[model samples]
Target: MEKLEERFERLERLAEYFIEEMADFKKWVVRFLSEYKREVDRQIREYKEETNKRIEEYRRENNKRWGELANKLGTIVEDIIYPAFRPVIRKYFGCEPEKTFMRLEYINREKGIYEEFDAVAVCQDKAFLLEAKSTPREKHIEEFKEKAKRFLQYFSEFGDKKLILIMASLSFKEDFVKQLSKTNIYAMAYREWEYMDILNFEEVKGA
Candidate 1:
């Protein structure tokens, strides 16, 4: 009887040692996982911030370049291109096409009003609002609103005058353009130079 009781107590001590070792191993595993998870989270945050910074820098550089190009293109078009077309216009219609230049702001009295239209050619009190894009896209409507609308009402106002809107772009979707045409407005693609087909053009002279 005495020997059996001693063996039982020894077995209990061994079992207790195993339970304590297992508890310590579990704690070590939990600590290791917590540290790894924190490091991974930090790396992900850093990656996101770096990506955003790079994207912003790219936009800044590209926008500067585009502005420069647009200015150059505008000068070239006004100088050489328009002159070439003028002779054609004179031969066909006995008149020249007038290109109006406008910015995104208006000086109304002492106050300033923000506007979207780039320019208009007014012939005989008819207003032809012009929106010029070097290369348009399918998602151009959203982009146009941002650049064109001056954080105010996004409206092109010929203002009770003969209202005509002409859009000049290289890549305009036919279906989307069809919808634009339905709005009692005119959209001009590269194919048709008569974008808005303004009655106010010099073609209607002596009418």
Candidate 2:
């Protein structure tokens, strides 16, 4: 009986030792998981910050490039296109402008709206409203058409005069020139050696 009692006591001590070891292992696992989770969260936060920084930098650079392009286009239109157009209009059309107006703004006080013209060259019997661009598109041509169609409504004083719509650009698409000619609008562009030349002059005369 004593021997049997001693065996039972040894078994109880072994059971207690196993339970303690299991509890220690559980604590170690919990600690390791907690540290791993914190490290992963830190890395994720850092990655997000870096990504945001790069995106902001990209946006700033893109805006800067667009601004520079706009400024360059404005310079070309003002310095080269406008100056060359005057001589070409005289040479090709044999019309000398009596008055050259720039940025003519008109407001309908009743409607509370306004329209603007880039330039207007007025002769004795004709007036040409000009739209100048670095790269002329169809939309620009359409806008000029709209303005010229409604010219008399705003400038009723010039009701007897023939209104001509003209566009000047550094370069033009052939398709755009064709479309402009179909509408009887004069499309002019810079040719080789950068002389201002009309693309649709014949069409304008024929129409």
Candidate 3:
């Protein structure tokens, strides 16, 4: 009976030791998980901050590029294409060639509206209502018609004794070109420079 009692005492001590060991292990696991969660949160915060910074930088750069491009386009319209059109204005309208006008506003059917146009070339007695299309399509007819009607309404104020609808399109459909021509509109496509008058060029260039 004494030997059996000693064995039971030994078994109880063993179970107590096992319980203490399990408690220590659970504490260690909890500590490790807390550290892991803290690290994950810190990393996520850093990544979001970095991503936002990059986005802001990209927006600034993109805005700058867009501004430069818009300025360049304005320069091309004012310095290059508008000047090249001087001859046509001089020949048809008998006006001095050194003229400049911007197509800023127009009236259609006597109704005023906010508008922007490609350009307006003017000499003393003639005005050219010019619109530039990167690649003109037949779909442009409605807009073109509106432009023409506007010119007809305001030609007298502009001293537009002669009216020319000058358009510069990168390209055009054959049917569109034919239809525009049939409408008695003087039109020129990219490949059709011969359609432009040389006498007008001579007068504009002082040749």
- The TM-score leader among the candidates is 2
Q: Any idea what lDDT model 3 has?
A: 0.64
The whole-model lDDT of each prediction reads: 0.53, 0.82, 0.64
Tens-digit per-residue lDDT, 77-170, candidate 2: 5677677767777977799988877777889899996987777878889887888877676687777777776666888877788887788888
lDDT assessment of candidate 1: 0.53
Evaluate residue 163 in candidate 2 and report its C-alpha lDDT on the 0 to 100 scale: 84
Pick by TM-score: 1 or 2, better one: 2
Pairwise lDDT winner, candidates 1 and 2: 2
lDDT at residue 23 of model 1 (Cα atoms): 94
Model 1: residue 53 alpha-carbon error in angstroms = 1.6
Pairs with steric clashes in candidate 1: none
TM-score of each: 0.44, 0.66, 0.54
lDDT of 3 by residue, 96-202 (tens): 74456765565465654546666776665566777766556776766786876766665557654465666655356667666566554544434454444422222
Number of backbone collisions per candidate, in order?
0, 0, 0
Candidate 1, residue 45: CA error in Å?
2.1
Task: Rank all candidate structures by their TM-score, best first, as comma-separated numbers.
Answer: 2, 3, 1
